[model samples]
Target: MSSTEHTSLAPVEDDARLPVADPGLGEHVERYTDTDPAAARRAYRQVVTMFGLVPLLAIAFVVVYFAVPQDLWVPLLGTHWPLNNLLLGLTGGLAVLLVGLGAVHWARQLMSDHEMVEERHPATSDAATRAAFAEKVNAGVVDAGVSRRGMLLGSFGGALGILAVPALVTLADMGPWPTAAVRRETIEKTLWTEGEVVVNDVNAKPLRPEDLEIGQLVNAEPASLFDLNGHDYLTEKAKSALIVVRMDPNRIQIPESRRDWQVGGILAYSKICTHVGCPITLWEQQTHHVLCPCHQSTFDLGNSGVVVFGPAARSLPQLPLRVNAEGYLVAQSDFTVPVGPSFFERDSRNDYQEGDQ
Candidate 1:
């Protein structure tokens, strides 16, 4: 069509509404870094320096791990510390943390800052429209000016490079090998060694077989806790804690091999819960069940301290008991198996070795 004919054919003002005028983008404001290239460069250098230092800190973490002996002590706040682990952890953590800070600073101070407009479109588009969108994204990158910012790019790269240091250092920190220190010292043994007298928790008095009545449940601990020498008060109390429960001898189901393990009708069990290691005292006298309040785990005192309910997967650990030369209640031996929750590498077969015996 001719231009004049096309103009004549176009809708007049009365037939069609005029399109809304574009408001255009907001007015651009120059940041301090934008106006001062020297200041921008300084900021970029500071970020790069932080990233560069991160790898050094990470290397220091590794050196501390190997060079510093685990048992060596350093005086701090009037207390001696085995500083190898602490120093390694701090240096490794700081290495990764500094890299993150450096990257954030580089992006905020030296990277490009601009605004652009994008026209909205329908959700579904044809193949040609999608290809055009990809080109627009590439154009957006040019507008962002990333390729022109050499200092910012360098700082970003350095920051990313340093982040690997902490990752490698942390792997070493995880372990040389698994340590069973806590299990061996705490769970496998208690205050109830052979010949240690059993003392009532309430009155701190030594108990005889006659002191307990049928269906009576008493909290007890090793007699060593009363002594001033040969043991620390806290350590003895933690390792030797126990609960003494007396029931009808006929109603008790003592294992065949453990028949003489109890003194009269009184049986002793570890106070530590088999669930999550809380001290369990909540008891049901009629059912001979002791319950843990922390997670509601219940154990049957009359049936080898077996777990009868709740989240506990194992029974409460049993302590062997006997009478001393003076006819007072005493421990026959320490707990045979580990107390508290089951661990990943726990020797279950060894634990159950004498179940039928």
Candidate 2:
């Protein structure tokens, strides 16, 4: 059609046929790096420098992982901070941040500056178009100048390779391989020992058989736990904490093997649930059952602390109890078995029925 005829057919104001105006790409301006070789070299160096710092930060992460003692605390803000965690986080975070920043900086400062719009087309492409698209990708890579820049390639590769070391070295934290000796020295034993008095956890006073009446339950811990401070106190208390309960001797079943483990009708058992280490706090006086509030695992305190209901797999570990010369309850020895949730090394045979020894 002629230009005048096209102008005459163009939609007027408020016409339903009015089309949206196309905002064409604006003028392209050359960057300093794009125009000058010296500027381009400097931009390349900046990105390489960023990538180079990532490897150093990664190395620092590993060094901090080994050098910093886990228990060492430093004051930060108004509170104490774990120095090991602080240093590791700082170094590891910087390493990852530098990698991302370096890629962004490289794309903006050193890669292609020309802009082109991609038109939407059918989703399925013919085989010839697919081949052409692959060629275009290769051409784009050439335009990016990645294959030609040895320093950028090497520095980026080194950064990513060194970053993996942090994860690999941390695998060491999982080991020394939880051998039988390590298990025995650690998870299998507690602060409770022969002659260690069982003290009421709240009052911190020695517990006597008379202190607990029938159907009464008292939360108790080893007297030796008071000697420890901070982490040691919590750690020992978690393993050695006990619930002392007194039941009618005629009503409860006393296993032949554990006959002397209780003093009179008072028995001491680990307060920790065998299912997932929740504390057994809810008490059923008449039934002599103690419930774990966290998961509702019930243990029959009247019948050797066996699992009477819920998901608990093993019976609660019983503490051998006897009266000292002073008439206060004392532990005859550490618990015969591990007390908390079942572990890989835990003996399932510890679970017993009424007739089993």
Candidate 3:
């Protein structure tokens, strides 16, 4: 036969079978609990015991959550144990697992175990069949004796209640907002002032204009950072940071109003990244660009620290600098504008009216 005839003949033979065998089902085995009251009662007690333990484990989980400090660690074998995390996770996980296991065990061993075979039927059941299904469900619920088992009901409810404690405890860290002192002294101001000396970050020496060569860039900080009190040390160190770069005067594009802001070829700009406030010092001598290592933000130092590339939204802040009568580099005044990342008030019309100078 040709391939087309053979293919057509194969389908015809397959279609010739009008009926298929119905395997029906095999014999169902009766469980011990089905015939014996004592065995059924024992299974009931075992399921109840597992459910009862869940509430106790949940309570232990709450206790561990509150009592353990977050930083506490214990060495076990060669691996370090985050004991607090380990204990809390294990107790809470076991409580939930036990509750599931108890429910499954009770359904299999103690509740109704009659084997049922549901024959294929039409898509929609008639009213009589629907009523019979509801009746069977109600009968199963009655046989389970869930309403009469006060201990199981109470223990399961308690376990669910105790699980909410960890969520409440975590909400405590949300805060009442920054303290007034922190808001005013740290966030709003920095160590830079009229006479604060600008010191080289590397050797911590005072900077002189003569010390900087053409096309040189130096990471710098305020002298007051070394003597800060309490949290001021970190606060001042973060905001008062500066980057000193020198280029030929002819290569620079200084605004007419900022002509006196630089001493010789040396200019200073805030080292804080405008993108997200990382301390930036990476420099490219030929391009006169200072790059932030965090997100590769590039700023052209010869053009008032203009952002040349990457994600930074604004230019790096320029710090007005001059030589004191004694020849040490000092800030001309506090930054005219706030020095870090942009905020809601920063771009408001009222803030821009104040101007960068």
Best by TM-score: 2
**Backbone N/Cα/C clashes per model:** 4, 0, 0
lDDT of 2 by residue, 1-357 (tens): 866664436655754555766677888889999889999998898899999999889889988998889999999999999999999999999999999999888889887888888899899999999999999899888777888787877887898889999989988978677889988998898988999999999878998888889989999998888988988999888999899999999999998888999888999999999999998889999999999998888889888988888998888889999999999999999888888999887776766665665
Give the C-alpha miss distance for residue 99 in model 1, angstroms: 3.4
Q: Write the per-residue lDDT of candidate 1 for residues 127-216, one digit (tens) a residue.
A: 999999899888766644457755555655665676675577568655445457756765566667889899987678999999899988
Once fitted onto the true fold, the runs of candidate 3 whose alpha carbons sit more than 4 angstroms away are 1-21, 35-39, 121-136, 172-273, 276-287, 290-312, 317-355
> Could you tell me how far off, in angstroms, the CA of residue 323 lies in candidate 3 after the best superposition?
11
C-alpha root-mean-square deviation, each candidate: 9.5, 6.1, 6.2
In model 1, what lDDT does residue 172 have?
A: 69
Look at candidate 3 and tell me the lDDT of residue 100. 83
Model 2: how far residue 91 lies from native, Å: 1.0
lDDT of 3 by residue, 1-357 (tens): 766664434554543674666657778888898889899788778777887777688778778878887667889899888898889888888888887887777788766666678978998989999999999999987766676555655665665676676667657667545565554554557778898899987677999999899988888998878876655677778888898988998987787767888998789999898788988878888889988898999888888887779998788778889999889999998765667776644532322111233
Model 1 misses residue 254 by how many Å?
3.5
Clashing pairs in 1: 190-239, 191-239, 191-240, 257-357
Error of 2 at 342 (Å): 1.9
Evaluated at residue 278, the lDDT of candidate 1 is: 86
Cα lDDT listed for each candidate: 0.78, 0.88, 0.78
Clashing pairs in 2: none
